[model samples]
Target chain A: MAFLARIYVTPRADVLDPQGNAVAHGLHSLGFGEVTEVRIGRYLEVRIGGSDRAAATEQVTAMCERLLANTVVEDFRFELDALASDR
Target chain B: MAFLARIYVTPRADVLDPQGNAVAHGLHSLGFGEVTEVRIGRYLEVRIGGSDRAAATEQVTAMCERLLANTVVEDFRFELDALASDR
Candidate 1:
């Protein structure tokens, strides 16, 4: 099996996003009148191989906890792609 | 127009990824001998509306520069989703 894993990391809700704030100010200057809030995050695309779906899932979940995510300030979640699916 | 933006924020190649390293060690502990390396990042999905494609693209790009991305340590890129496309 192969997988493309996307992880989302953000400051906790109570934490302010200075980058997002700066961008919001920039948007104000750029004439995007309808925009209100902006938040920033990250994405990762991973390819993993395994003999079976169960094995792949196990491997990926472990991968996330140990390497892909920081449990302190961020939360992690992912979805599996069908073996032959196109990106 | 609507967009699903996936931002990939990774340490520069010169920078070491401790979280990724820790996960690699964990995988080694879990008996998955085939694993080699791990890297982590974040993802974001956004929805935008504009009267025209050009306007939408302009707004989205501005959004990325002004709010959605941290240019200092991270690189940002995004793709547009057809307004009616399914997630």
Candidate 2:
């Protein structure tokens, strides 16, 4: 089967996010006082050809752990949708 | 009112994604042959204090247009959640 994975990799809440802080500061300077905090992360869409949903889940999880996310400081989650069956 | 905005910024389908291509190549080299393609983008969480939904939407739309997205090469979409009523 063909599957599509939408992955979100975000920094753990306990971690200090300088980028987010900087963005919030910039927004404040731009006169958006209502803007409080900003957190930035990564979004990925991965297309995979796999046997089934279970198999795809395992594969995507491995991908997230091995390459997609910095598991020490960041956390990752994903949703998978079946695209089509392989020919 | 308090609102949380989950924003997704992605490269347009027609845009050239060298980063995606490179990541796909890396995955293939790492033996994840089932991985076909990878498109990478940015995810942002913005917390805002506003008067109402209509006001928040207008504010966020301006943020996207002016600072959040490039608008030329990327497209952005966001979902807003009301956090709580102000004290």
Candidate 3:
């Protein structure tokens, strides 16, 4: 089976996110006073071929732990769906 | 009222994403041979104070148009929700 995974990697809430802070400042300067805070993260789409959903999920999780996210300061999660073209 | 927006900015399908390619290579090296393709994008959380849902939605749209995305090469979308602690 083939699957597509949508993965999100976000900084742990307690971590200081300098990039988010910078974007918040930029939004403020642009007159978005209503904008109070900003948090930035990475979104990834991974396509994988595996024997089944469980195996695909395992592969995606490993991908996150090993390559996509720095687990020390970030948390990662993903959703896997069977691809329409899997046939 | 306070609202939280989850925004996604992704490269257009036609654009070449070098970063995505680099990650695919890394995944292949890590022995995830079943990994076929990868695309990377940005995920953002924007906290806003607005008068109403309509206004908040407008603000989020403007933010994407003006700063959050390069519309010519990227596409952006968002989900807005009423914050529970708006009081």
Candidate 4:
């Protein structure tokens, strides 16, 4: 089965996000006063050939831990979908 | 009303994604053979105070153009939800 994994890697709450802060400031200056906060992160789309959902989940988790995300400063989450049906 | 907008900004398909290529190579070297490809992008969570969903969407679209994404090389999409129920 071919699965598409959509992953999100976000900065840990304790980590300082200078880029996000700067964006928030920019929005305020642009007259977007209604925007209260902006947090930036990474989004990844991966296509995996796997036996089943469970197998695909395990592989994607390993990928996230090993390379996709910096675990020390980022937290990762994902959603998996069968690609054929979606297509 | 408070709305939460989840946004994804991805490099245009024609754009060269060197970082994604490097990560894919690393995955192959690490023995993740079932993984065929990886594309990297940006994710953002924005909190917006608005009178209604339509108003919030318009504001967020402007935000994406002016500050959230570099439209020259990227494409963006978003999903919005009322924050109260989600919380």
Candidate 5:
């Protein structure tokens, strides 16, 4: 079976996110006073072929550690869905 | 009430994504042959204060159009959850 993994990589809470701060400032200037905070991150969609959900999760986790995410500065999470039948 | 909106902005399918292509190539060279394609996008978390969900949705949508997303080359979707009690 094939699986599609949707991963989100976000900077650690303690990290300084200048881009996010800039966007927040822009929003405030535009009169969106209700919008208090904005944080930006990376979204990734990865397609993989595997025999089962467990195997696919293992593969995707390895990919995250090796290439998909930088654990030192970012944290990652993902959701997997079977895609063979949808196509 | 307060709500948190999680937004994802992705390049339109017809548009060219050089960054995504570069990541795919990098993965291919790293021996992940099962990985077929990769699409990169932006993930954003917006914290908003409002009295109701419908009103909050309206505000968030307007924010997306005005600043949160670039409607020309990208498309966006969001999920909202009330956050008043979480704290």
Candidate 6:
């Protein structure tokens, strides 16, 4: 099976996203008034093959935890789009 | 006001995303067979104050170019979900 996964990796809410904040501040400096906050995150689209949707989901989830996302300060969520198993 | 902006910053099609490739290789190592490709990107949620939608779009576009995205290697698209003007 092939799937289109949209993975979002965000700084845990309790963890401040300084990179995001710095960008926001920079925006303020560039005259974008009242830019309050910016939350930065990562997105990934991966093509995977599995026996079934659940199996693919499991594989992708493990892939995320092991390599794609850092669980310490970042949180991740994925939306799975099951495509025909052509490839 | 508040907005939920989904910003996608992806490597230009011609540019290689080594970090993404590395992660995919790691997935293969971990037994997610036939995983073809992985493209990584950045997403952002921001809060901004603008006179109107057009103004907000312009401000956010500028923000993406000046600070949020690396135009040389990356291409970005943003979806703006406008909220009520209470804030």
Instruction: Supply every candidate's count of residue pairs whose N, Cα or C atoms clash at under 3 angstroms.
Output: 7, 0, 0, 0, 0, 0
- Tens-place lDDT per residue, model 6, B6-58, is 68898998998898888788888887766888999898988876547777787
- Stretches > 4 Å off in candidate 5: A85-87
lDDT of 3 by residue, B1-87 (tens): 689999999999999989999999999999999888898999999999865998899999999999999999999999998887643
Per-residue lDDT over A1-85 for candidate 3, one digit per residue giving the tens place of the 0 to 100 score? 6898999999999998999999999988999998888999999999888659988888889989998999999999999989876
For residues A19-55, write the lDDT of model 4, one tens digit per residue: 8889889999999998887889999988888658998
Question: What are the per-candidate TM-scores when only chain A is compared?
Answer: 0.73, 0.92, 0.94, 0.89, 0.89, 0.89
Instruction: Determine the backbone clash count of candidate 5.
Output: 0
Q: Which digits, one per residue and each the tens of the lDDT, describe model 1 over residues A9-60? A: 5656566777766755666777666555555655544555554667767777
Docking class of 1: acceptable
Indicate the worst ten consecutive residues by lDDT in candidate 1 chain A.
Answer: A78-87
Residues B32-82, candidate 1: write the lDDT tens digits: 565555565545544554546676677677766676556665566666555
> What's the DockQ for every one of the candidates?
0.24, 0.84, 0.90, 0.77, 0.80, 0.72
Off by over 4 Å in 6: A84-87, B83-87
Q: Please give the fraction of native interface contacts (Cα pairs under 8 Å between A and B) kept by each candidate.
A: 0.30, 0.79, 0.86, 0.91, 0.81, 0.82
Identify the candidate with maximal DockQ: 3
Clashes of 6: 0
lDDT tens digits, residue span B21-72, model 4: 8888899999899887788999998898875999999999999999888999
**Reference-based TM-score, model 3:** 0.96
Ranking of all predicted structures according to lDDT, beginning with the best and ending with the worst: 3, 2, 4, 5, 6, 1
**DockQ score for candidate 4:** 0.77
lDDT of 5 by residue, A25-73 (tens): 9988998888878889999988887668998898788888999888988
Report the lDDT tens digits of candidate 6 across residue range A1-87: 578788888889899898888888887888877687788989898987655788778877888898888999989999988878774
DockQ of 1: 0.24
Check candidate 4 and list the clashing pairs: none
Question: What does candidate 2's lDDT look like per residue over A5-86, in tens digits?
Answer: 9999998999988998998898888888999889999999999997689989998899889888999999999999988675
Candidates in descending TM-score order = 3, 2, 5, 4, 6, 1
Please tell me the TM-score of chain B in candidate 5 relative to the true structure's chain B.
Answer: 0.91
Residue B82, candidate 1: Cα error in Å is: 13
